[model samples]
Target: MEKKPAGSSLSKALTMLNHVCTSPVPLRFAELVDLSELPKATAHRQLNTLLEHGLVRFDEHKQAYYPGYGLLALAHRTWANLDIRDVAAAPMRDLWSSTQETIHLAVLDDAEVIYIDKLESPKSLRLYSAVGKKGPVYCTGVGKAILAYLPEAKQQDIIHQQNFIRHTEHTLTTPQALEGNLQQIKDTGISLDLEEHEIGIKCVAAPIFNARHQVVAAISVTAPAFRTDDASYETMKGLVKSAADDISKRLGACD
Candidate 1:
């Protein structure tokens, strides 16, 4: 039997943590072993270390390991420190005030759209999603808009890695289908979520670019299906696009 160096063991543990961070649910020990290609005993030892350090936690009932509360604390720290939030706050407020629809600001994390900020609509019949909620990059408007503008290799990598889980009848579950939709979004510079991720919610989204002309985030206006008729969709589409453009310009994205 051969023993790995301390540095190698630490690297493997970090690799396992990175894999779990992107997953939607906790993973079993066997799953981690297979994914990380580590010996079962080594994986177990690493898991125990992570658990003790509050970097990972075990679910007794589910028999799976997931990221611990410490990871969430770290995520909060990162979010609070990022300059994008400061750059986006004023524009986001303006978008919310003008549309009166639920406006969301999301960034890409592990190929998924992670909502960092949200402004709920004041209307009685408005659609709402939480700030910390994560959704597939293929079916959601914000996700698609950002993904469409990403580098081709990165987009392919994400499509290949993620399961593309179908949440509703309208969800695009296949890579080819999603690719086609992304192409359409790239062509039109707009994205739509027509009851794709959620059955009764629709969204209009546009990409926010950074100083390097890279799509760094997305802005969206979500509304209930009943209020998302053709005319309203068109109107909101233009509005969201304008807001995204404003944010991008502020971020120094130019022609």
Candidate 2:
């Protein structure tokens, strides 16, 4: 075996790790060697380096390599320091421009959604939701958007935490009703407030996913119910979903 420069070896190892992580299933050493297109000995050497550093782990029972907990810890650190508002700014502006509706970006906190960013519409009538304000996950578009995509266990936990306050006549006031609405949102990939959070205010929203395809946030386009006719509502739904998709892609979400 010939010695490779440290930089070259490190690059190859990182590239191999990318392949491993992107794979839909755990890979055996032989599969990784073929997938990486690296010399068998070089691949072996890189795998050992990755395992030694805790970046990768070999599953003894399955005889395959999987992402290690060390990588998960690193991912958690990366997400903790990430600013979702920064990732969503461009798309939010574009959505506001297209729909002439207020744009909001929010993330789940406990059982609620906290507004992290807001772009006001140019129109005289716009949603007055302030950044940093929190709203119930069961009644708001952005909140439901995030809640709908959560795992069933987590979703139930959050649902139980809701006070089930009837902020408006349209609000889903029961766990069963909210769960049904969430199922529809998850199926259609969109959520509608329909004046549920506040009288006269309505919105369309979509979930934003991270690299792991987990729902990390949501984006919305809000307007007064009077102006959100069926046609405009349909348009805003697409715009909000598209904006969410763009932001999700920026955060490294895959199809």
Candidate 3:
């Protein structure tokens, strides 16, 4: 019969929501309680509040909780507010239509890259990245494209913070190795994924400059290795760079 402040209650609810969203799989009520470390009654009450608002949903068959459609609406609104995404939409569509490959638009955030827009290919196999998901800059094409244009100090800071966990044999696991690749990307104004993020998935990417002539975002074209090879990547590199240039011009960047 004790009263808690409104702020405390809101924090508890938000914490529980994040726990459910970040879990690798749908989480049971007891699992959420354990992860959130909140009292049983308090955890249940907060979960009910979120579920009622549709921020979270319960799976009856699996008896677990996952992020709901409500989050999708919020995500849509969030991306809609980004001018870069709006500006890049047309060029992204054009590039996707031309190549029939997946297209991704991302921006550097802290030491990682956050996917803001994604156009899925008709192919059966696809990249695991999704809008709102965060990926390592050292391993992803978009990440490397942005990193190549970042100031040296900023690049070093990001590289130093990375855990360098290898996702594939092709992944660059050391700052020295990644730096070499970054230099190459800077020289050519293009970057390659080379199955570094996931096996069978490869991409070519280029950075989009803002009105201030600073790298603000990156665009990439991704395909399965089964359908593409070294020569295809070289072709993709040109396409991606051209699309990026188009987006950059729309953003008011000068030659």
Largest lDDT belongs to which candidate? 3
Q: Which sections of candidate 2 miss by over 4 Å?
A: 1-77, 126-128
Ordered from best to worst TM-score, the candidate numbers read: 2, 3, 1
Could you give the C-alpha RMSD of every candidate to the true structure, in order shown? 17.0, 4.4, 17.8
Q: What does the lDDT read for residue 113 in candidate 3?
A: 98
Q: After superposition, how far is residue 79 of candidate 2 from its true place, in Å?
A: 3.7
Q: Residue 198 in candidate 1 has what lDDT?
A: 88
Which residue runs does candidate 3 get wrong by more than 4 Å? 1-82
Model 3, residue 241: what's the lDDT? 93
Task: Select the stronger candidate by TM-score from 1 and 2.
Answer: 2
State the lDDT of candidate 1 residue by residue for 1-255, as single tens digits.
533444577898898887777788789988888888787788888888888888888899999988888886775676446587677788889888877889899999997889998888898754446788887888899999999998999989988877888889999999999999999999989999988988899999999997668899999999888878889889888889998998888776785
User: Candidate 2 residues 74-152, lDDT tens each?
Assistant: 8788877878888888898888889877888999988888999988878876454789998889999999999999999
Error of 2 at 126 (Å): 5.4
List candidate 1 stretches off by more than 4 Å. 1-82, 125-128
Query: Candidate 3, residues 1-255: lDDT per residue as tens digits?
Result: 432333588999999999999999999998988888887889899999999999999999999999988987876675446699889999999999988999999999999999999999987764689999999999999999999999889989999999999999999999999999999999999999998999998889999997668899999999998889768777888899999999999876889
Q: What is the lDDT of residue 101 in candidate 1?
A: 81
- lDDT of the candidates, in the order given: 0.85, 0.88, 0.91
